[model samples]
Target: MNSDQEHYIQWQKKEEERWEALCGRCGACCGAFDKDPCVHLSRDELKKYYCTIYENCFGIKKTVNGNDIVCGSIRTILHSHWPGDDCCGYKKALKEKN
Candidate 1:
C-alpha cells in the first residue's frame, strides 16, 4: 500500500481506539441494568461489562429472561429507550456536544 494509505489506516485505528475510550464501561448498554440482560454479558474485575461474543454480537439473541431480540451496534440503540438509557456514555457525550 501507498504511504498515504498506510497513514490513513493507522489514523483510523487510533481514532477507533479513542472513540472506544469514551465509554465509561458501565455496561448499561448491554442491558446490565435491565430486568433481563443478554446471556453473554460478563463483568470484568473492575465490574465493567463486556460481551463474551463481542466479535459477532449482531443478530438474534436471548436476554437473561429468555426473551429473544436482535442485537445491533450501539449506533442502532442510541435513539431508543432502554432500562439504563440515561447511563450511556455516547448519549451523554452527544448531549454535551449539542
Candidate 2:
C-alpha cells in the first residue's frame, strides 16, 4: 500500500482499538445500576456482558420492567453515574491522559 493509504489504514485501526479498549464490559452501564436493565444486555458463555444488538445499541430502549428509556453510547454518559462504572476503561484512560 502507498504511504497515504497505509497511514489511513493505521489510523483507522488505532481508532478501532481505542474505541474497543474503552469498554470494560462490566455490564454496570447496561443495567447493573438500574434495578431493571434493557433486554439487550446479554451475558456470553464466559459471563462477559455484551449487547445483543450492538450495532443498533444507540437509541431508545426499554428496561426489563418495561420502563421507557433512551440508550446511547457509553461515551455520552462517561462523566455520569452508573453501576460498576468504577472499572470503566474510558474513565481510567481519560484520567491518565490528563
Candidate 3:
C-alpha cells in the first residue's frame, strides 16, 4: 500500500483501540443488573466483567434466564437505556463529546 494509506490504517487501528478502551467492563449492557446476564458474561478477580465469547459475541444469543437476545455493536444501542448504564464509560465519553 501507499505511504498515506498505511498511515491511515495505523491511525484507524489506534482509534479502534481507544474506542475499545472506553468500555469500563461493568457488564451492565450484558444484563448484569437485570439479573439475567448474557450466558457468556464473566467476572474477573478484580470484579471487572468480560465476555467469554467476545470475539464471536455478535448475533443471536441467550441470556442466563434463557431469554433470546441479539447482540450487536454498543454504538447501536448507546441511546437506549439499561439498568446501570450511568456507569458506562462509553456513554460518559459520548456525553462529554456532545
Candidate 4:
C-alpha cells in the first residue's frame, strides 16, 4: 500500500478507538430508555452495551422493536438530545473547558 493509504488506516483505527472510548456503555442513545433498542445493540455478560454491527452501523437502521431511524456519526448527534448522552465523554470534555 502507498504511504497515504497506510496513514489513512492508522487514522481510521485511531478514530474508531476514540469513538469507542467516548461511550460509557450507558445505552441511552441506543433506545434503551424508549423501551426499544437498535437490533444491533448487544451486551456482554457484564451488561456493557455495544453495537453488533459497529463497523457498518451508520445509515438507516431498525430498532429491536422495529422502529426505523437514521444512524450517523456521533458528530451528527453531538448537538442533539438523547438519553445517556450526558455520559458522553466527548461532550463532557467540551462542556468542562467552555
Candidate 5:
C-alpha cells in the first residue's frame, strides 16, 4: 500500500527468512531420531531433511507409524525434548543469544 507499509512488509519478510534459515533441516523435530518421523519429512540428496508439505505443515499430521501429531511452530516445542535436540540450530541460537 503506502511506502511505510511496504517497508514494514519487506522487513517482516526478511525476518521470516532469517528465522527459517536457522533450521539445519536435520528433521529431529519431525521425529527423525525418534525412529518415527513425520510422513511428510523427506531427505534430500545432500542428506538433509525437509518437509514435503512445508507451506501447509501447521496442524494435524501423522507419523510414519500412523501416530497423530499436532504440528505447530518450532518455538512452541523449544523447551521440550526431542531425540536429537542437542543439535538443533534454533536452540543453539537462543543459547548464544542469552
Candidate 6:
C-alpha cells in the first residue's frame, strides 16, 4: 500500500481502539442480567466480560438459553431491544446524540 494509505490505516486502527476502549466491560449487552446470554461470553480475571470469538462474533450464535440469535455490531441494535442494554456504553452515547 502507499504511504498515505498506510498512515490512514494506522490512524483508523487507533481510532477503533479508542472507540472500543469506551466500553465499560459490564457485559450487560451480552445478557449478563438476563436468563439467556451469548454462549461465547467469558469473564476475565478482572471480572470483565469479553467475547471468546470476538473476531468472528458476527452471524448466528446460540445463547445460554439455547436460543439462536444473529450476532452483529452493538450499534445495529443500539435502540432496539435487549435485556440489560441500558448499561451499554453505546446506549449511553445514543442518549447523548439527542
User: Best by TM-score, which number?
Assistant: 3
- Report the lDDT tens digits of candidate 2 across residue range 36-60: 8788888888888889999888888
How would you order the candidates by TM-score, starting with the best? 3, 5, 1, 2, 6, 4
TM-score of 6: 0.85
TM-score quality measure for candidate 5: 0.92
The digit string of per-residue lDDT tens for model 3 on 1-98 reads: 99999999999999999999999999999999998889999999999999999998999899999998778999999999998999999999989999
Mind giving the per-residue lDDT tens digits that candidate 1 earns over 1-98?
A: 99999999999999999888778877787778866888988989988888899899998899989988678888777777877778788889888988
Report lDDT (Cα) of residue 85, candidate 5: 97
CA lDDT, candidate 6, residue 10: 99
TM-score of each: 0.90, 0.85, 0.94, 0.76, 0.92, 0.85
Report model 3's TM-score to 2 decimal places: 0.94
Segments in model 2 whose C-alpha atoms lie over 4 Å from true places? none
Pairs clashing within candidate 2 = none
- True-structure lDDT of candidate 5: 0.94
Candidate 3: where are CA atoms >4 Å away?
Answer: none
Cα RMSD of all models vs. native, in order, equals 1.3, 1.7, 0.9, 2.8, 1.1, 1.7
* Residue pairs in candidate 6 whose N, alpha carbon or C atoms collide under 3 angstroms: none
Give the C-alpha miss distance for residue 76 in model 6, angstroms: 0.6
Residue 31 local lDDT, model 5: 89
Candidate 4's residue-wise lDDT over 1-98, tens digit each? 99999999999999889877877877777787677788888888998888888888888899977898677877778778887678777678668878
Instruction: Sort the candidates on lDDT, descending order.
Output: 3, 5, 6, 1, 2, 4
Q: Can you tell me which runs of candidate 5 are displaced by over 4 Å?
A: none
RMSD of 4: 2.8
